[model samples]
Target: MSGFWGVARAIIGREFLRFVHQRERFLAALVRPMVWLVIFAAGFRAALGLSIIPPYQNYITYETYIVPGLCAMVLLFNGMQSSLSLVYDREMGSMRLLLTSSFPRWWLLFCRLLGSTAISILQVYTFLALAALFGIVLPLPGYVAVLPGLFLGGLMLGALGLVLSSFVKQLENFAGVMNFVIFPMFFLSSALYPLWKMAESSPLLRDICAFNPFTHVVELIRFLLYLQINWGALIWVLGSTVVLCTIAVWGYDPARGLMKRKS
Candidate 1:
């Protein structure tokens, strides 16, 4: 038991140290979402009118509504960034070293996911703090309440990164992931706009958005932040996390991994 905790702590510490050294990465994570909130959302607020959506009893400002989505955006980007680092580690052979350690592979992978999720939670809170400063405040309890949703959402996204890194053989090839996976996941989801709005435009697109895992991630946060429960969103997030994590672990398995080909 102690050994498991010790290894997890060491991995988490390493992740934190890497984050501290890369100040720009932290800044970039916050900047992308803040830009959307402060600039783009302001212009769009007047153009797109949101009705009283679930978890929102009254019409809300675009900034206020998008907070959870932006929070998920922070998680999404940071998750990819963490995966980028994994690709770097693989190219440099550090991943093999870490994997070959005495610790069980699943435990080690869990630690990695946990570490990334922890950093993501910190970034989300910092973003929320800035949002509050900018006059987009939620209920005081909402701040505390959002933690689990953030952690779950972060874990799900980070697991996704792990799955992608498992398939991608090189660092340079990640651009395709950004183009195909990241962009679609963000834009097609309920992150920036609600599904009813999409329905007004195209019912098919609205149905597609409903199936997006990122959509549930955002909705989970939105409901938790507003002190509401969305059972559908919760089930979607939980199911997706389980499925993604299973795939990630399988991808990294030596027998199932590219290592079998190389060996």
Candidate 2:
């Protein structure tokens, strides 16, 4: 038990130290969503009208409506960036050393995921604070209430990134792959517009968005931020996390998976 905790602490600490040194990474994470909130939302405030939605008691501004989604965006991008670092570590041979440790590979990976999720949550709260400064405050209790949702959402997305890291062999190729996964997931979800809006445009497209895991992620956070629970979203996010984590574990399996080929 001591050994297990020790390993977990070391891995999580390393991730934190790495993030602290990478000041630009922190800034970049905040800037992308801030751009959407400050500039894009402002432009679209008049263009896209929102009705009083479930999590919202009254009509809200475009900036307020998108805050949760942008928070999810921070997690999504950070997850992919964490994966990118994994690929880089693999090339540098550090990941090989870590995997070869006495600890179970899954345990090591979970620690990595946990660490990434922590960094992501920190970035998220910072974004939320900045949003508050911009006059997009949520209920005070909602800030405390949203932690569990953020943790779950972060783990799910981080697991997805772990699965991707196992397959990506080189650092240079990750950018294109990130784009392939990131853009569609972001644009097609309820991040920018509600499902009803999408349904109004095209029911087929709306169905596609409904099926998207990212959509549920956004919904889970959105509801939690308003001190509500979207039970369906919670189930979807939890189930997706398990599935993705299983796939990631298999992908990194030495004897039976991609790691075997790499070895």
Candidate 3:
């Protein structure tokens, strides 16, 4: 048990060190959300007048409504970035060396996921803090309440990234992932516009948003930020995390690691 923790700690420490060295990555993460919150939200505030959503009692600013979604975006992007790093490691043969360790692959991978998630969580809080400064604050308790949702959302998205890493042939392939998976997931969900708004244009699109896993992640964060329980989002996120992790573990199985087969 202690050995597992020891290995986990080492892996997490390495990830942290790597993150710190890449100061630009941290800054970029913060900047993307801030751009959306400060510039984009401000520009859209008048155009995107929100109706009374469940967690909201009355009309709310577009900035306030999109905060959870932007928070989810941070996790989503970081998760994919984690996977991109994994592919890079594999290509450089580092992952091969790491896999040779006595630790189980799933344990090692989970350590990687946890480490990336921790960094992502930090970026999220920083974004939230900056948002508060811009007068886009959630309630005090909401700050505390949002952590669990962020953690779970990060875990699930990280797992998804891991799965993608196993399939992605190389670093160059990552751009396509951002275009296809990340963009589609973000835009199709309740992240930007409410489901009813989508339904107004197209019921099919609204239904698609309802089923999106990212939607549940955003919804979970939204509800928790308001001190409410979104049981459906909770269930969806938990189930999605489990399934994605299982697949990721399978994708990187030493007996059939994609790197080995692809190389």
Cα shift from native, residue 11, model 2 (Å): 0.3
Q: RMSD of each candidate?
A: 1.0, 0.7, 1.0
lDDT of 2 by residue, 1-263 (tens): 99988999999999999999999999999999999999999999999999998989999989998999999999999999999999889888899889989999999999999999999999999999999999989999999999999999999999999999998877889999999999999999999999999999999999999999999999999999888999999999999999999999999988887667666
Error of 2 at 113 (Å): 0.3
Candidate 1: residue pairs that collide: none
Question: Taking the tens digit of each residue's C-alpha lDDT, what string does model 3 give over 1-263?
Answer: 99999999999999999999999999999999999988988888888767897999977889999999999999999998888899899889898877888988889999999999999999999999999999987989999999999999999999999999998887887898767999999999998899998999999999999999999999999999999989999999999999999999999886786766767
Clashing pairs for model 3 are none
TM-score of candidate 2 to 2 decimals? 0.99
The local distance difference test score of model 1 is: 0.92
Candidate 3 lDDT (Cα, whole model)? 0.92
Task: Candidate 2: list runs displaced more than 4 Å.
Answer: none
Per lDDT, the best of the predicted structures is 2
Q: Model 3, poorest ten-residue lDDT window?
A: 254-263
Off by over 4 Å in 1: 261-263
Compared with the true structure, model 3 gives a TM-score of: 0.98
TM-score of each: 0.98, 0.99, 0.98
- How high is the lDDT of residue 124 in model 3? 96
